[model samples]
Target: MNKAEIIVALDVPNAEAMEAKLQEMPDFIEWYKVGLEIFCAEGPAVLEPLKRRNKKIFLDLKLHDIPRTVGNAVKTAAAHGVNLMTVHAIGGRAMLEEAAKAAAKCENPPKLVAVTTLTSLSQEDFVDLGISRTVSEQAVELGRLCMASGIDGMVTSAHEAKALREAFPDALLVVPGIRMPEGDVGDQKRVASPSFAVEQGATHLVIGRPILQAEDPSAAATAMLNDMNK
Candidate 1:
């Protein structure tokens, strides 16, 4: 159960749904992510069962706010014993720095990851929002700012992983928007196979629907692990 094998995105609607998935999860997968949906639905209580199972938890709340607020939020997340968490680089340097500082003080700090442009967003989407740069460009710039603020890692698409690895060799690149060869891309505009993501230097892969929607989730997760190792 190496950290890189798989990170199941617990994107279910509530704790009950997550528990149902957990019952079917394979032992090979050692990590699980609690995203906004579940976190908002079940709150911190959702994490208790996963912890009881000895699974490393990644709280993906994607916190974004003013400096003081975000900082306090990071501290609170750390107290919950989550292994990883995310903030928005778009939240600006002050907030990022504040979060970083808060994480640093935690006795066992959760890895602070920053969200760049989401995989669901395309260059056209950015254009529609009056952001003139391409999606890749914006992601890279945001990655830089996150690094400068001293955060542990970032959440980006596999499409940008190689370039980002080159630019920030020491920073962890936790990627989402992963699709298996036979999997559907769904709403994600930027995606890569598990093997491709690993070869490109991604430290972690966040997978949701492909595993969750599979007829056999544990087997699907195992297959994804095999693909990543290949």
Candidate 2:
């Protein structure tokens, strides 16, 4: 059977821990997300094996910096053979445009995906950060800015997926912070089921923990794929 359009997060402490989970992953699970923790721990060298095995990579460093700095970072990420890399849309249009331009120069440029509001935040959380915009309004605004800046993909909460998809019809909305129905939410304040996101027009799903922490990782992944198929 075709696997679900899911990207499993390899959020372990180090390359060794990620390697252990790699062996347990179902064959149909071809894409992997190497986020800030593991990437910082092991560096791009850690993803070399995944590339050798031909697995697609989503390098989620959530780059947020000045235009020149973010641009330089994108060049390096693309050179590492990542299929997707993230920048924060909150960094504004100039930086987004610069990162896009940098990626355009790579021999095998990774798709530039800008991050909207993180899913771990709530309305209360926004107020704490001194922002008045509701989470949904902020996400949509950032997504619009990213699109207007020429980035085609965005990393956003599944809670915002339907509205984001509506606002940016052609975007590759990579919804993170996914949770199974009635599953433990961990630190994510905004979450959604895989089926609900699919129904709402999310182009991809970035799921961590739920599958990785399951007793039988392969079975958990397979079950998630089955769930997505429904």
- Per-candidate TM equals 0.96, 0.96
lDDT, model 1, position 199: 84
Identify the runs in model 1 with alpha carbons over 4 angstroms from their true place: 1-3
Clashes of each: 0, 0
How far does residue 159 in candidate 2 sit from its true spot (Å)? 1.4
The TM-score of predicted model 1 comes to: 0.96
For model 2, what is the error of residue 194's alpha carbon versus the real structure, in angstroms, after optimal superposition?
Answer: 0.5
Cα lDDT tens digits for candidate 1, 1-230: 12465789988999888999999998878889999888888889999998899999989989998999999998888888899999998999999999999999999988899999888898888878999887778878999999999898788898888888888888888999898988899999898999999988799999999999999998889889889988
Q: Which ten residues in a row have the lowest lDDT in candidate 1?
A: 1-10
Could you tell me the C-alpha RMSD of candidate 1 in Å? 1.6
The clash tally of candidate 1 reads: 0
Candidate 2 lDDT score relative to the true structure: 0.87
User: Which whole-number lDDT from 0 to 100 does residue 116 have in model 2?
Assistant: 89
